[model samples]
Target: MEIYSSLGIQAGISIFSHIFFIGITFYALQAFRLDQLFKKGRTIQIQLIYILLSIAIGSSVSNFILDISNWSKQLPYIFT
Candidate 1:
């Protein structure tokens, strides 16, 4: 029960952090005038690629770490 509660709290924190990171990324992009450097069509394409890559990288990294942590937590019981 205690472990479950800890996991829930960690998950919530992870979600909040990801959201905050994405917000900061967009804010920084706009502040830097990155959009102005590209032609209209290229800008849209670049933005789309940037967003897709961010989601893919973030999801994989987060899931991999979470899975490793979960495995480590189970290892003690399995070994015993």
Candidate 2:
């Protein structure tokens, strides 16, 4: 029961972290003028690309943060 509770909490944290970072990535992406790199008038396609890119970058960053956190929590075991 305790393990299941811990797992649920971790899952919730992971989901929240991914969503938060993805939003940040999307906002940051707005500063780029991607029109020069794609066909003109392909607004829908460009938006889709932005979504995919944001997920890619955001998930990577979130994973890195989570891994670092998990590692830090385990550091004390190295001396034992």
Candidate 3:
């Protein structure tokens, strides 16, 4: 079915894009050695913050892509 095929394509693209975004974000953070800037116990907190921020950024980017593709009418609803 055309509908099912299109859905599958979109899903695949979304997953791949998210992985790429998160991977690049982590790579950049690691390259900066952000952990070294924090104390031992604080490293965990910083890592958590970095990861969440990366996800938030990735989600926003993906939402923007979806909007540009005209896949959905509404803007991203969260964190507004």
Which candidate leads the pack in lDDT?
A: 2
lDDT of 3 at 63: 70
RMSD of each: 4.7, 0.6, 7.2
Q: Per-residue CA lDDT of candidate 1, range 1-80, in tens? A: 99999889988977865665555555555545556667886977778766765566565666666678778888899767
C-alpha displacement of 33 in model 2, angstroms? Answer: 0.6
**Candidate 1 Cα outliers beyond 4 Å, as residue runs:** 1-4, 16-40
lDDT of 3: 0.76
Best candidate per TM-score, number? Answer: 2
* Candidate 1 TM-score, true structure as reference: 0.58
Residue range 6-70, candidate 3, lDDT tens digits: 89997998898888887777666666666776888796798897898778877777777766776
The local distance difference test score of each candidate is 0.68, 0.96, 0.76
Candidate 1 weakest ten by summed lDDT: 24-33
Ranking of candidates on TM-score, top first: 2, 3, 1
Once superposed on the true structure, which residue ranges of model 2 sit more than 4 Å away at CA? none
